[model samples]
Target: MTPPLAVDIDGTLTDSNRALDPRVLDPIREWPEPVVVATGKALPYPVGLCEFLGIPVRVIAENGGAVYLADDDELEFHGDREAAQRVVEEYRELGHEVGYGKVDFTNRWRETELAVNLDQPLEPLKELAAAHGMHVFDTGYAYHVTSPGVDKGEGLRAVCDRLGVGIEEFAVVGDSENDAAAFELAGTAVAVANADETAKAAADHVTEGSYGDGFLEALDSLRDA
Candidate 1:
């Protein structure tokens, strides 16, 4: 039997322009096993994606700050939101723009962490998060400030427990550092051709294709396995 799939959204399922590639929809919807949409994006994005894709609403959002399973209608939050918010506030006080400007929706719906635009200086942000006992993850698209124990691996473990599946019974795919934890827990970890170095290093296999094509390639490999 093919292992269940846990896949990232941005660099993994999107095109170079960061738009969702329609190509991945049918295959994911048709997959026999459960498919989890794991991403550094906010909870609503992945949840809505699952609804639109006609798949189970299983997701690890905010880089693992949040986990939701539709089967049981469960939603769990793991990160320290207050601490993350404080870091962002301090960053703003330092005269550094969060990058998303005022009235930023990128963080409006975020409940457990802060997602800052990539244009901001990473080092200072990292330092601030660290000072608050939080961690900053660069997902290649944004800088995510989350609690130390909150990560995709732990989120996946939570989902697995609810589903009665082992942590090693999933095949995970991603293209950034935020996905590394899930890679470590997966039985097979796949990275796209455009994957960041950190992601490639953790992956068991690197696809020759990029973006959604790479995701399709990974799915094919799983089917063949």
Candidate 2:
């Protein structure tokens, strides 16, 4: 049986500019594991990447805030609708320029969460977040904003609740301040060497190396553990 696998995208799966490393992809292609790509990128992005990897049907996108389960052999949506709306409402009230995510008929989640793209500057974004009593930080090419207390950790916990699994039953890998909280709860938390200092500090362990090279190394550790 495939041991359950939960991997992160962005800096974890790809390099700094959203580039995929064939070296890492090779191992994952043959990995005897249930791989899930968790990231802040909503449908079409990670979804398409997972498909290219020939592993579709399941993905935890938009950070841990959304989950996609293939419908009729094709993915359409993530988890609860009500919860997503509630969270979006809270985020908007916090003054973020939030927008609902509805890719190919999936609305289980309804917010962009953050704008981490090559089209914007970070300073103004930080000032805006500061003025609104929120926080904005970068994760490679994306920016994250949430009321003083919400993020991937909260979403990961929701995943645990939905799955009826304990924190110790899973492993998580990522590379940013956003990834810190969830790392605390995982059975094994790994940060790639190229990760920001904050992520490395919070990590239960650091990946043996950088990005793609390091991810493959970390997976071996999880399989061994």
Candidate 3:
């Protein structure tokens, strides 16, 4: 079997506005192997989107803090949940906008990481997280606070193990600083035209288009490979 395709959501599958092109769904579902939706978004949103698109696949949510397999409909958390929660409280105490409770409805379903709206600069947040022995990642959509060792690369590695695939057989598509780890893990790392410099620099191929168009371009390349 072909290695699975792991893709980031915010700036890869969807545009800046979080709008997915309907055209990408059919091809994705028709792909030869599994299509894992790896993202910084919470589990529900990605799982819901996959359902609506009629695409059955596993999901790596909360920026590698959790994994949800659609077949079994189970969520397996990978990060230190208590530590993630503590970081949220710490961020809140530090006067950052950390979304918990009803602060951000879109972020309500997350369990292992804290998602902060992009109302402030991320460098300070990263610094603060480091002070607390945590890590902060900017996903172009939000800032994710996770345990120091957690990242999308780990999530993809887990997915590969569960599916009996190897990292060298996988193709990863992403467009943010948070995507750097997974890009490093993939045999073929593709960055959309709109990708942040760090992500692009980590990629093996940079697409000419942004969002879904870029994803489609990468998918074509992978198929032709």
Each model's TM-score? Answer: 0.98, 0.72, 0.90
Candidate 2: list runs displaced more than 4 Å: 1-3, 71-110, 116-123, 147-149
Kindly list the per-residue Cα lDDT of model 2 for residues 12-58, writing each as its tens digit: 88775668877787677776755566676665666787788887545
Task: Give each model's whole-structure lDDT.
Answer: 0.92, 0.64, 0.81
lDDT of 3: 0.81
lDDT (Cα, tens digit) per residue for candidate 3, span 112-132: 877777776577677777777
Stretches of candidate 3 off by over 4 Å are 1-3, 71-74, 99-103, 121-124
Candidate ranking (lDDT, best to worst): 1, 3, 2
RMSD values for the candidates in order, in angstroms, are 0.8, 6.0, 2.1
What is the RMSD of candidate 3? 2.1
Quick one: ranking by TM-score, best first?
A: 1, 3, 2
Candidate scoring better on TM-score of 1 and 3: 1
